[model samples]
Target: MSVLVVGASAAGLTTAEALRRKGFRDPITVLGAEYHRPYDRPPLSKQFLLGDWDETRTRLRPDTMLTALDAEFVLGDPAVALDGHTVHTTSGRSLTADHVVIATGLTPRRLPGPDLEGVHVLRTLDDAAALRRSLTPEVQVVVVGDGVLGAEIAATVCKLGLSVTLAGPQAALMEAQLGAVVGGLLGELHTAAGVELRLGVAVDGLTGVGGRVSGVRLANGDLLPADVVVVALGAAPATGWLEGSGLTVENGVVCDEYCRAADGVYAAGDVARWRAEDRLVRLENRTNATEQALCVAANILGERQPYRPIPYFWTDQFSTRLQVHGRPSADLTIAEGNIGERFVAHYRDAGRIVGVLGWNAPKQTRAHRQHLVRT
Candidate 1:
């Protein structure tokens, strides 16, 4: 049997490798839109952008390791459409397989404006490299988002000695995930690190000069001067190719508990929205990408395993390492603590712990994760 994986990033690569590890030695083909090999994304906005790490360091696996999988890699050609069991690529190649795995991941949301020179979105390796090249000590950067990506970019650029302004419509940074209390603390952290926080502001458009982005125009008619603008406005699933493919496509490709989208078709990673608890969630983190890929591979191998994931994410900014495990809710009763100088917050839903957030407290946070797992 032939298996086709549409996407060559972390989720797709892991799925292909896991299939081999699970003793499925049938013909395997991996298709990637990008020409480069699969690389780690988390470092793109942090160490990679800061010049602390090179492009080679971002690779998920070395060439030698990937060669051992013995899968046919079709790079620089994206699957443009899906018809029955045949996948059509943008290069006009049609390949048929017994089973298909969709892991297209996400595409960054672009701002409504003409493509300016200094405006960038940090989702791909090339995007990070371009933004890094534009960064300078004298350059003033305005990041128009307060989410994790926006916050990380702002922090990285600030550490590079560039003046940065973080503007977003949210009342507090990461208010949806970390809650206002912890989110406000993060705002303080960014402010203390020389990042100007412009919260609760609506951006109208971008102002340009000589065909280059100059500043961010606010709805209230104020323009924030910017030498560079990074739009970390989140991303949308790259599932346009799956249109009319007889699969449920909501915000992402809706899948069953086993990550099955349709007969002989499965999905994993940021592109797969699976049933979790009573709701459907599409996780876009490195941990979920790897975990879901393995689960999908297992299910494909007839293990009949359900993808029950305990969501985990981490971020590094300045001198703080923020780690979180489990689903965090704003209404959860929080128990706060301080280990040495590190701050830790345990979120409890009812009497059972639902989530744990730690600021530079990895060990304690992991210990709390075990409790969450038991319950």
Candidate 2:
């Protein structure tokens, strides 16, 4: 049997490694759009952009460990189309495999404006490198979108001594995910760290000079001067290649509880929308990518196990490390600790703990996460 894994990022690499570790002696091939080896992405916005870590240090596995897997690595070539049993690549190569695992991940959503030199998006290693090259203490950066990615970029740029303005339509930072109470605390955190927060503002367009982005125009007719603009408006799944592949593609490639898209075809990571609690949900975090890939691999190996995990994610900004477990809800009754110091919030739904969030309270939050797993 032959297995073809599209995408060579964390999800794809983890799936391939899991398959081999599970004693699958089949011929396996990993296809990557990037020429570089699989690397961790979380550091790109933090350590890598800050120049504290080099490219070699970002690799998910060293060359020695990758060589042990004995899987063919086809880098710099992306699969453009998929037929029943054949995968077509942009490099004019056609690979036939018995099983195909789609882990194509996501593509950054571009702003509606001209493609200028200084406008950037942080998604890949190349994106980070380009953004880093343009950063300096003199440059003023206006990040559009107060989401997790935008918040991280703003924090990183502020730390680099560059003036950063974080603007978004949300009432507070990460309000949709963390609720207003915790999100308000984050808003205060960023403001205290010298990041100019422009909440509840919508960007109308970008003004440019000499064909490069110069500033951002707001809907209320205010212009925020900027030498660079980073659009962290979230991302959409990279599912264009699977257009006519006879698979269910909704918000993402819809899959069953087993991560199966079709017969002999499975999907994992950001590109997969799996059935969870009677609703289809797609997670883009690194933790979900790794966990779901392992589950997909096991299912591919003939173990009929359902993929049901307690959703977890974390973010590091400035001096705070926020960790969360389970689906946080604004409707749940919230019990919060001191907002001045290290804070912890316990969210309960109908007398049962549904979610827990912590700001610089990792140990206590982790202990509370067990409640989610047990119940």
Task: Spell out the clash pairs found in candidate 1.
Answer: none
Say which candidate scores most in TM-score.
2
How does model 2 fare in lDDT?
A: 0.90
Worst 10 residues of 1 by lDDT: 332-341
Worst 10 residues of 2 by lDDT: 331-340
Per-residue lDDT tens digits for candidate 1, residues 149-204, read 99999999989988999999888999888888878878988999899999988788
> TM-scores for all candidates?
0.96, 0.97
